[model samples]
Target: MNPVRKRRFILVSALVVGAATVIGLVLLGLRENINMFYLPSQVNSGEAPRDRSIRAGGMVLEKSWQRDELVSTFVLTDRQGSEFTVRYEGILPDLFREGQGVIVEGAIGADGVLAAREVLAKHDENYMPPELADMHLERPK
Candidate 1:
């Protein structure tokens, strides 16, 4: 093979290999970023994956939101509106409210309950007023 042609070929091969390696690493790293969504019923039925981090979304069951100053309790629902009681120990999102949508991430316990370590609440752009977000607004009247 011509010397220049051989060098070019080696360069192209190295680039391809490097690109593949980067792609593989990116996908592996994405594992931490990826979250699966499920419902309370699915978790109770053992359908939700256990041990693997997952997100369970549902409406906060009316009157289900309870707390002992440390562990906050609430409920999640499915499409059919079926509800499940959820107890968690952590500071809830500002958007977390009754009848609001919420996602809990954690593992499912053998007792047919979802034991989560992290909780993420969803809200719309209207959720927080500009003043509230900027911390310059007065109390809602």
Candidate 2:
């Protein structure tokens, strides 16, 4: 090939490699920030990653909320009756209560309890949280 044509081909190849590298790095960064959402059943079935950050959503089980001086424990249940225990060490949201939709973000422990770092409560009847909505969960009748 002529010198000019060879140089053009090399430049195109370099541009393609650089673009691919940038895209790959962006995806790797995003993967670290992506917290996957799961339901109670998925947690109960051991489908959730044990040591990675994740989000779990379901209705707070009736009569299962207990608060101590520094910690709170509760059971989260889905419509299908699957349940998992959650232990949180911070102040819960004002709208949080039993029988209401809630989502907790944290990691599952070796003992099968979720150690929640954050708790979010769905306050209104008409508005559903996007994560729960994505799962198509229906509120209790």
Candidate 3:
């Protein structure tokens, strides 16, 4: 084999290997950071992954909100009535309320309670500002 051709082959092979390594590393990083969304029913049925960050969305169960010092605990219930306990330490959003929609980001502990890092309130499509709630503005047909 010619010297020049051999050198070129080696360079091309190294470039291909380097590209593959970079792509593999990027995919691995994404896998570690990606969080999956699940419903309360899925969590109760053992379908949700444990020990990894994930999102669980449902309605806050009525009369389930409890606050003790900094930590707050509540139950999230899905349409099917399946429920899961969530504990959060940070200040909750003003929209956070019982019987309202909420999505929690956290990890499920072995004891089956979610250690929430963040909580987001989900609102309906027709939701209006609190200041406008008293004003009944009908949608234009």
Candidate 4:
């Protein structure tokens, strides 16, 4: 065929292939992200993603929290009081207190529970503090 026609055909094919390649890579990257955000109950029930990164959220069980001086061993519990003991070797967030909220990101073990690579303790809100939440919650508005 004509050189102009051949060149245009090649350009179109290249653009289509390039777009497909970019979409494929983005989909691959999102595969791990898709398996994210599970509740503690879900985690305990074996619903967490072991092959990818995930976020596990729940209420820190009161009285179930224990910090080991020798190690950073601790337990996190759900709203139902179900507890999952976690072993982390790093400085925990200042907001990581008992009965507070937390959302951990990592992988789940074959034995169950998360083998967390990153732990994020959630507080009441950006403005509200735990003490304030407690005061407001304890006393009626």
Candidate 5:
């Protein structure tokens, strides 16, 4: 083969390998950072992946909230009545309360508890503050 052609082929092959390596690294990083959402039933039935970052959402079980210093523990119940325990070591959202909808991002431990990294409380669109409920306002036509 010609020397010039051989050098060009080598250069092209190297570029292709380099690009592939970069893409692989990017995908690996993303895989580690990506968090998946799951419901209580899915987690209870062994459908949710264990030891991976995930987001679990459900209603906060009544009388399940326990707070001690910085750590808070609670149980999340889905529509199907399946419940999962969650432990968070940070400040919870102000709106968080028993029976409220919440989504927690964290990893499911080997013991089947969610070790929450963050907690987000969800509210309905028609929700109104109790202090403002007494004052009714007319809707725009």
Candidate 6:
């Protein structure tokens, strides 16, 4: 092979290899940070990874909430009857209540409990703000 052609081939090969390496590194970084969402049933069935961070959302089970000072524990359940316990060590949101929808983020333990790092309250479409609750709106016929 000619010297110039060999040099050009080497340069192109190096550029391709460098680009691949960079793309691989970026994917690996993202994989670690990605938090996947799962249903209570899925988590209970062991479909979710025990070591990775994940999100599970469902209605807060009635009479399942128990608190101990700064720590709160509750059960989340879906309509299919699958339920899981979650433990969090922070003040819950004001909107949190029994039968309300909530999403918890954290890792699942070997005992099947989710060690939550964050809790988010979810409201339905008909939910009205406290300030607007008392105000009546006139509808156009």
Q: Which regions of candidate 1 fall more than 4 Å away from where they truly are?
A: 1-35, 79-81, 124-141
Q: Give the per-residue lDDT of model 3 (tens digit) for 26-141.
A: 98889735644688988999888899988999999989999999899999998687999999999888889998899999999988999999999887788678668655545453
Candidate 4 lDDT over 1-141, as tens digits, reads 799999999999999999999999999999856754677776677666566767777776667655677345456767575557665656778888776888777676665656667778876645777899688879964
lDDT of each: 0.76, 0.88, 0.89, 0.72, 0.87, 0.88
TM-score of every candidate relative to the true structure: 0.57, 0.62, 0.64, 0.56, 0.65, 0.64
The superposed Cα distance between candidate 2 and the true structure at residue 22, in angstroms, equals 20
Best by the lDDT measure: 3
For residues 1-141, what per-residue lDDT tens digits would candidate 5 score against the true structure? 699999999999999999999999998889734644677888899887888888888999989999999999999998577999999998888989998999999999988789999999988688688667556444343
Which lDDT tens digits does candidate 1 get at residues 58-135? 888767777898788777876474666677888888878887888888776666456768888877556666767566
Candidate order by TM-score, highest to lowest?
A: 5, 3, 6, 2, 1, 4
TM-score of 5: 0.65
Ten-residue segment with the worst summed lDDT in candidate 3?
132-141
Backbone clashes, candidate 1: 0
**lDDT computed for candidate 3:** 0.89
With a 3 Å backbone cut-off (N, CA, C), the pairs that clash in candidate 1 are none
| Global fold similarity of model 2 (TM-score) | 0.62
Candidate 5 Cα deviation (angstroms), residue 42: 1.0
Clashing residue pair totals per candidate (backbone < 3 A): 0, 0, 0, 0, 0, 0
